[model samples]
Target: MGVEITSPNFKANAREALDDNSLQKALGLTVEKGFIKKRRLAADALPEFEALRDAARDIKNHTLDHLDLYIEAFEKKVVENGGHVHFAEDAAAARQIALDICRKAGARTVTKGKSMITEEVGLNDFLQENGIVPIETDLGEYIIQLRGEHPSHIIAPAIHVNKAQVEAEFRRVHTALPPDRDLREPESLLAEARGILRDRFLAADVGVTGANFCVAETGTTIIVTNEGNGDLTQTLPRVHVVFASIEKIVPTLEDASQILRVLARSATGQDMSVYTTFSTGPKRPEDPDGPEEFHVILLDNGRSALLGTPFQEMLRCIRCGACMNHCPVYQAIGGHAYGWVYPGPIGSVLTPAVIGIEQSMHLPSASTFCGRCEGVCPMRIPLPKLMRLWRDKAHDEKVVPTAQRFGLGLWVLLARRPKLYHLAMSVGMPLLAAFAGSRGRFRSLPFAGGWTRHRDLPAPQGRTFQQQWRARRFGR
Candidate 1:
């Protein structure tokens, strides 16, 4: 759980990810063919999907504008419901608050639903260090936990891992199981994981979960999951801890429902997730089963700082991961290359804001600006624009590499001199085309080894775009 800032080493990480054949196969199968196609079909089936996206975006925007008031209201409601609310200024404070709660409850083992906020704070290792065992009840989270790796994808944490890898990991970790167990199929593997996790779930003393939407009006925390693990993780334990960021608050249950209409369709291409659990507080005397103690931890962690800034739009993210699934760059290298709790398009913009641009300068430049991420985003967060803002900030701060800066400087100089630029391009194009005897692509090129090493670069067609435009326009 030494989830260090490897965003600085993004290029190297990307190279490694590209070379990993297994990772490539996983990306192709799970992302390109899986999420993308499913989401498209789901969106097409729902005529009001686009309108729903707009509503979701507006709902989040309203909450962000009056975030302070809504947070207070949410806290008040939780208190009225017999729940405790703790606000953490940062990741460290959040982790400490969680540990304190566990200690007070005498929790030796805690079961967890899928929680990115927990991962953001590195909670698993912290709990282990504090003599508490935190078990990931989410299938994807559990898989990565066994491998001792962070989530490579947001909703699908183990998307980078293939079925074969799971089989191997299950065999390696679940040594108590039969050596010849049939984990060749997805169902078989899921059954094996459930069997192993069922025991841990029952034995857990505390439960921790992330909030999908915290309804301020009712003081309710909603979690949407395909698997019913979240219900067990929260209900079976003596104490339940709800960890969420400040932006997750919604003004009312109606607003949450509006957003819910798009969340699953965007994330997993379902009309609705299999289980959408809502919890208000600890159990009552009349209740059948539930935790005895309920605690809510709200972590700011630089999010409050983004309130009025250009990056404020990023707070609208519901972690649906639609943007990432549609991102070309993400589909190519997978999420590990981004090297953070969040990955892909949203991560590209948010990581720098949370962690600082100087540390994550490469992330903004990771996109092709194809605009697919923005187009697919359920929140309508202008991801490409936000990424461009990061890039511009990086440039202004001189955080960009010297070579890139030099290239930009030269381009600026050329762009300002129309005649010189035209002359340079006209003279350079034919020479490049001449050098290419037959094949119209270069195997390698000066200052372009990165492109050529992986794939051929198409040679110039011996004419500048402007010249071609002139011919087509003027019939020269």
Candidate 2:
């Protein structure tokens, strides 16, 4: 499970993301407008949407407070239902456990449903290195798997890929198919992918999936999906394995329901996903179609250490993708720029917490501090506040660049002396305005080429607030 780290070079990643025309077009069409507009309409249609969000938040908070108890309860119930629950303290342990299970089952091929947890631990690569083939069954996942790319967005793994790119990938990988066949339309592409994966599903020895929620009251694992691929992936295989973080538990089915109400609306703008499958155990004696073995691998991977910290609130995330959908930075640069399993505002906070702030310090600086992410989050996570905490920690630990630290030092020095701050602003505004000429904007400016290079910087609209206040108060 050796995952490549590019978080240390986030500015470079973001610049590359911004310059890619194909990625930009895809982001503009699908991310910038599609999800945002649909979520708005869906939220507006439901009068209780906001109340549901609040309820979801409270449910997650309560479960996190008693996380150990619920996890124990869930494990007990799973045992009772004839399923095995394995606890892994870190990604390495989780990977080893999964490999052991696969080896014991004599598995040669594994079919996978969409699971970010598996991606976080680099399970597919690890399995491939060990002589097991893991196939992605989800359409988006299949596309990215063929392209050998990590997911660019949660819930929409191939969002960065356009139709033409997909068509090309299909032609390259699905060589057994007719070369002259038409795959110009998305429907045709889907049909071809479905035809190819159907055989893999039948031949699979193990299936891996992620749990949206693990219900403690009844010992259930739940997944919400728009497609039915998850059903086939789990039910058709001899061994079914779930890869999930410890934070994905709820006290009761009612609590899970409370969160589910807001999840689909926030994520895909649907009243509900097309399929919400619940798995409790291995195949029973009377069951016609189910896995012979059922296993749940709960990976902590630094999440347990965050329980009492300020970042603990991030555990409330339900992975709805709403924060990323509404995030301006994410919309501009997409998920790959954040260079992690989770992305956008939540990733900015969570990556630092899980992976260490030193390696991911640049992520927190990628935001514009816009509140849209928090506004749309169904779980009501205070994302910007969490990001600010990371930024402060980075600054305090000297993890940020020397130039940034120097700039902050200068600003802090200027801010402390009110008279000097006002005097500097008063003198600075007139000179800036005079240089702007009649355009009321500056196309080029010293120390602000970053802004002016992309778009003109509006000149100081008027005198500084302190000067206007002084004139009005003293008639100076």
Candidate 3:
């Protein structure tokens, strides 16, 4: 949110993190191999994954179409159940609402379950600025918070970070640990974190989480997680706040269940997470332990604006991270490269819309159009197509450079006339060959200095493939 991360310059920060070859090697191994394992696991588990995906997508599309009606229904039900609903048009408003609630309730420390909406609104920073401490309770989030780094992956926030790095982070951040501590095992590291976080969770006056789905028919906020931290975060503190995009609303628990069927299966290869919790409202008077106060912050934040547009399909996202996990660009460059809170295929499209399309012009173009992200998305979102629309929007807004404009223009001209295009290629090839010389690599070339600056570009052979094909067919 504070900084901009485009695909091109994110490389610098990653290179810095990769100053040691080991970190780079670690990231490469995880990004490439881990995804393959997960993909295969999901495929092996579900014989009708494609069918499930289609059903999921249709349900989401239906939900998006009736979002306004569902949201109104959700609001009415929440109020009827004694939970407060606050609508925010933007991040600042959402942050202010959260801050106001904490202040009124005399909150000191707040524990948070991982919520991307909170991250979008900068809730932690806002609270801290006002002298309230907000601790991330999710294990991955806790690690990144300690390191002052952002989440690299949506579901697996610290996916790029290795165990040793986490051990170092723990030693640096954990107060109870001795300076001489050298823990390597994940269990030990987790135990240390648990000790620290457990105390925070118990002492906190407020707890917050993001909703996976909100049922309009029942006014329930559904949270799905493996570690059960979300349940603790929602129930432990006196007050609980749920920050979510309005698009998360579905008509009923049945719809939520359908989405859930795809969420865990696509995410972690599990039929269901260890915990799939749905909190209806504030704790009943007779209930022994649950939040006394419940607040739901519905963030509009350009989301509602996209409802009727082509990008509205994005609202169907379950935040599964399947798109990013399976994304080649995200796998190679990591999340920080996207330069916004959201990353990968979803981020590439969403960030531009949330921020300005101009600032994130390069994000959509980062994709290889592989469509793997789309294929794996439980919601079956057309991620690449949406990204292309973003690119078109960027081009229309003149965010793209004149160089790109001219190049595309020339390409269009060449495509429209086959004969002249062949003639131009025939003449251009030898000149390119001469420039490339015996090495067959171009270091720098006209209008392509940006590309050749980092890596050598392979020279095109003097013979065009089309010409060779024609000659072979005719035996010339």
* Candidate rank order under lDDT: 1, 2, 3
Q: Which stretches of candidate 3 lie over 4 Å from their true place?
A: 1-23, 179-182, 430-476
Off by over 4 Å in 2: 433-441, 460-476
**Candidate 3 global lDDT:** 0.85
Q: Where does candidate 1 stray beyond 4 Å?
A: 430-441, 457-476
Query: Candidates' lDDT values, in order?
Result: 0.94, 0.92, 0.85
lDDT of 1 by residue, 1-476 (tens): 33578999999999999999999999999999999999999999999999999999999999999999999999999999999999999888999999999999999999999999999988999999999999999999999999999999999999989999999999999989898778899999999999999999999999999999999998999999989999999999999999999999999999999999999999989999999999999998899999999999998999999999888999999999999899989998999999788999999998998789999988999888999999999999999999999999998899988998898899999999999999899888989998986899899999998798889999888888887888899986
The window of 10 residues in a row where model 2 has the poorest summed lDDT is: 1-10
Please give the ranking of all candidate structures by TM-score, highest first, separated by commas.
Answer: 2, 1, 3
Q: Give per-residue CA lDDT, model 2, range 115-204, as digits (tens).
A: 999998889999999999999999999999999999988899999999999999998888898989999999999999999999999999
Rate residue 359 of model 2 by lDDT.
Answer: 92
Superposed by TM-score, candidate 3 places the C-alpha of residue 134 at a distance from the truth, in angstroms, of 0.6
Q: After superposition, how far is residue 205 of candidate 2 from its true place, in Å?
A: 0.7
Q: What is the C-alpha RMSD of each candidate to the true structure, in Å?
A: 2.3, 1.7, 2.8
Candidate 1: 10-residue stretch with minimal lDDT: 1-10
- The local lDDT score (0 to 100) that residue 149 gets in candidate 3 is 75
Candidate 3 TM-score to native = 0.92
lDDT for model 2 comes to 0.92
**Tens-digit lDDT track for model 3 on 263-375?**
88888777888999999999998988899888999999999889889999988888988888788767666777677788889998888778878777778887899999988
Better of 1 and 2 by TM-score: 2
